[model samples]
Target: MNDITISNNPDRERFEVSVAGKVIGKAWYKAYDGDGQAERIFYHTVVNEEYAGQGLAGRLAKAALDETVAAGLGIVPVCPFIKSYITGHPEYEASTVAITPAHLQFLDKALAARA
Candidate 1:
């Protein structure tokens, strides 16, 4: 497996990872209102089908989360996969904002719009 390069594409508000010049996965996230703070992150992530099960997505998510933490911002995962990732990784828990009813409402509407 080639080394993966992860970068924040601020213009696109997403984290992009490429291997051998081909994008293998990406995690989308942005600062948004979280209960009371505006700097809370709402993250969404995806891995290219061909790259799935190879841990590329997790790497991309980790890299992105690292950046957010460095920026001194907290995260609220709008992506189910990210939520799951956070579940098994308690180290990142302190940076996470619990998903509340308001967040759930937003996510529901978002899923519906995409459907």
Candidate 2:
């Protein structure tokens, strides 16, 4: 097994998974500032095709969630991968928040701004 590592890239707003110093997967998130708290909305997760079935995605998700919880932020799992991952991991329930319509609206604006 290669030395798999994961780190949060705040500038990209994603958690990156790397192997042997090469990034091969990422879990993208957006932040929604509300009520003096930051909610991290995980909207997309992707692992390189060559790295599929290696559990890197799960590792990446865990790292991202860990960092968010550690930072005292909420986790809004808008991505199916993240939502399902949290469902199977009850430990994250405390930090997880269900996605709302407002979240979708916010994402639309964020993505559009980037485009």
Candidate 3:
């Protein structure tokens, strides 16, 4: 509920949201493999630690998702937070790549093996 500003930089193809001139959140996305798959984007993200728990990340995600929908792109949420957010918000479900429990198990195993 703060004075947040959201901007979509077409040149960079990312949407940014800031608070008081400080960038607190962002959604990075692009056309998949230069294919005209504008209806599908790969995402990477982070929310400022100071701004965590304020729902700022969700707000930013929502804005980006809305933009992606407007642009007709399905979402490939590579960020864990974004993936979790989609699970809770069914509105974005259709645009998401389903990450089942099996996927988590595999990821955990892969990470542990590397450690």
Candidate 4:
């Protein structure tokens, strides 16, 4: 198995994993600024079909969450995988913020604006 590399593409609002420069997985997120604070809401995470079962998703999750915490931003785990991942990882629990109606509204508007 080839070693995978993870990187954050802030413009795309995702943390991606690649094998020899070809992207194989991504964890998508959106940044919301409100209530005088900033948050990164992780909404989806995926790995290429052929890349499944290689632990790439977990890798992406770890890297993405780590970076979010390092950047001093709260994490709103809207994606089930991210929410579950945080559940088993106690270290990241401190930075997590539960999803609320305001977050949902913000996400709806942000996604709608893109469409």
- At residue 3, candidate 3 shows an lDDT of 81
lDDT of predicted model 2: 0.92
The TM-score-based order of candidates, best leading, equals 2, 4, 1, 3
Clashing pairs in 1: none
Score residue 36 of candidate 3 by CA lDDT.
42
- 1-115 in candidate 3: lDDT tens per residue? 5689887767766778888877677776654522344343435677778878887778888888887777677676766777777888889887665544544454456447656
The models' CA-based lDDT, in order, is: 0.77, 0.92, 0.69, 0.92
lDDT (Cα, 0-100) at 78 in candidate 1: 71
Residue ranges of candidate 1 with Cα displaced over 4 Å: 35-40, 101-115
- Candidate 4 — worst ten consecutive residues by lDDT sum? 31-40
lDDT of 4 by residue, 45-73 (tens): 99999988978899899999999999999
RMSD of each: 2.8, 0.9, 6.2, 1.0
lDDT of 4 at 26: 90
- Give the distance in Å from residue 20's predicted Cα in candidate 3 to where it truly belongs: 2.1
Give the range of the ten consecutive residues with the poorest summed lDDT in model 1: 35-44
How many clashes in each structure? Answer: 0, 0, 3, 0
In TM-score terms, candidate 1 sits at 0.79
Winner of 1 and 2 under lDDT: 2
Which is the better candidate, 3 or 4, if ranked by lDDT? 4
lDDT at 89 for candidate 1?
Answer: 86
